[model samples]
Target: MLYVFLSICCSVIVSILLKLARRYSIDISQAITWNYSMAILLTWLFFKPQFQNLQAAPIGIYTAVGLLLPLVFWIMASSVRVAGIVRTDVAQRLSLFIPLLASFLVFGEALTPLKIAGIIVGFAAILCSIPWQKKTANRKVISNAWMYLVVVFFGFGAIDILFKKVAAFREIPYTTSLFFIYSLAFIIALTGLLIRVFNRKARIVWPHIMFGLILGVANFGNILFYLRAHKALASNPSAVFSAMNIGVITVGTLVGVFVFNERLSLVNKIGIGLAIVAIILITLSQH
Candidate 1:
């Protein structure tokens, strides 16, 4: 339970850090590239020996996970830029329903009435949270970047489902799988950095770079802890993941309101309520 709580807290911190990174004029792509590099290094330092006994298939699984890291971060950051944090987050969280459905249909996971209710409510909340409006006479309402948010939703949902499927395979240690994935992500991201450097646009702001490094360590720590919790409580990892989302949304909302002074409209307030209810339902359904 403590591990679960800590994992949720750490995940929330990732979002806060990303928001702060935005304030510093950081290049999100460069920061993410560096972040994965740092994560791979730190994870290897702590867990490299654990991989010695793993079978080959888990290595491929981990590599797949690594390939997803950049896609997830890039789309998420673009979503934040286009849709604002609140809406972007709501969409991201609600997107987990896709995996939940997949778990049921593909993995024979049972969906209780409460889980179904939660999914419906969560989806409704996400829809309510979106800020749709007509374009002004002189300005476009929805930017092209908003498409990235949709990608974030679908891509991340697929990633989560894949992770769960890999975890269920049981032939390899979870830590071994994670290490391979992070290492692969690092290689891919480094290649991207090299390409960017050749383009002469790869400026590394030291502060953002260091922050990304710290965030990388923290991100891997969260994954390590969550994997532990999932191992211990394998019957319902999705429930734990949903709880983490609740923590992220709660902390992110507070930061947006008090720290960033972002305004919440009446619709957003209602959406928050619905999101809370959805999380509660999802959690309860795990029983």
Candidate 2:
């Protein structure tokens, strides 16, 4: 339970730091690039993942996750900027449904009554959380705002599926696979940063490095604590899963509304409520 609480705090802190990035003139690309460096360091130091027989690893999944990680991360940052933390957090937390969708449609898993109900309610939650008709310069800009939210929804969902694939690959230890993925992600992010710098679109600065390191710490802590929570509750996996998804949305909502004064529509509030109910149903279905 303590691990769950710490993981929730770390997750929300990452969102808060990203929210503050543009305001503080931080270069997000550079910061994200450096973030992987810190993650790699932590992985090496704490996990001590050994790189034995890389040939046996699922290189295809590793490369795909490496490509998608930084890309989806950037999209998430954009979503937070456009959609606010509340909606973005809800969409992310609710991404667990993606794997379930895959299981039913692709893997031929049994779809019980509770799973069906959870999916139905989860769909409604997504529709309500989205800003369908908001005032902007034009309809396109309005669409663009909610578009980030939608992409964040599906993008994170797809990433979740890919991560499950990676986790299932028992050829290598999960920690070793994670280290490889993080290393590839760093290489990809650094390539983009260097290109931007060469094109005079960005520069290497100390502030971005500092912020990136801090962001890395929060990001790594989220994974570390969540894994710890799972290990601590190995007999009751449902508790950790439910607590993590629900906790992030709950804490993020409080911080988003109170600290940042983010506004939410009446429908959006209802959607958040439904999202929580949907998660509860889904967790119960597992039991």
Winner by lDDT: 2
Q: Could you give candidate 2's per-residue lDDT for residues 137-219 as a string of tens digits?
A: 43234456778888888888888898899889887888888899999999999999999999999989899999999999999
Best by TM-score: 2
Q: Which regions in candidate 1 have their CA more than 4 angstroms from the true location?
A: 52-55, 58-60, 134-146, 228-242
Query: Model 1 scores what on Cα lDDT?
Result: 0.73
Residue 266's C-alpha lDDT in candidate 2?
93
- lDDT (C-alpha) at residue 283 in model 2: 96
Q: RMSDs, each prediction?
A: 3.3, 2.0
Query: What are the lDDT figures for the candidates, one per model?
Result: 0.73, 0.90
lDDT of 1 by residue, 103-176 (tens): 78988998788988998998778666665543355644654544665677778887887788777876666666
Residue 261, candidate 2: how far off, in angstroms? 0.6
TM-scores of all predicted structures: 0.84, 0.97
Tally clashes: model 1: 0
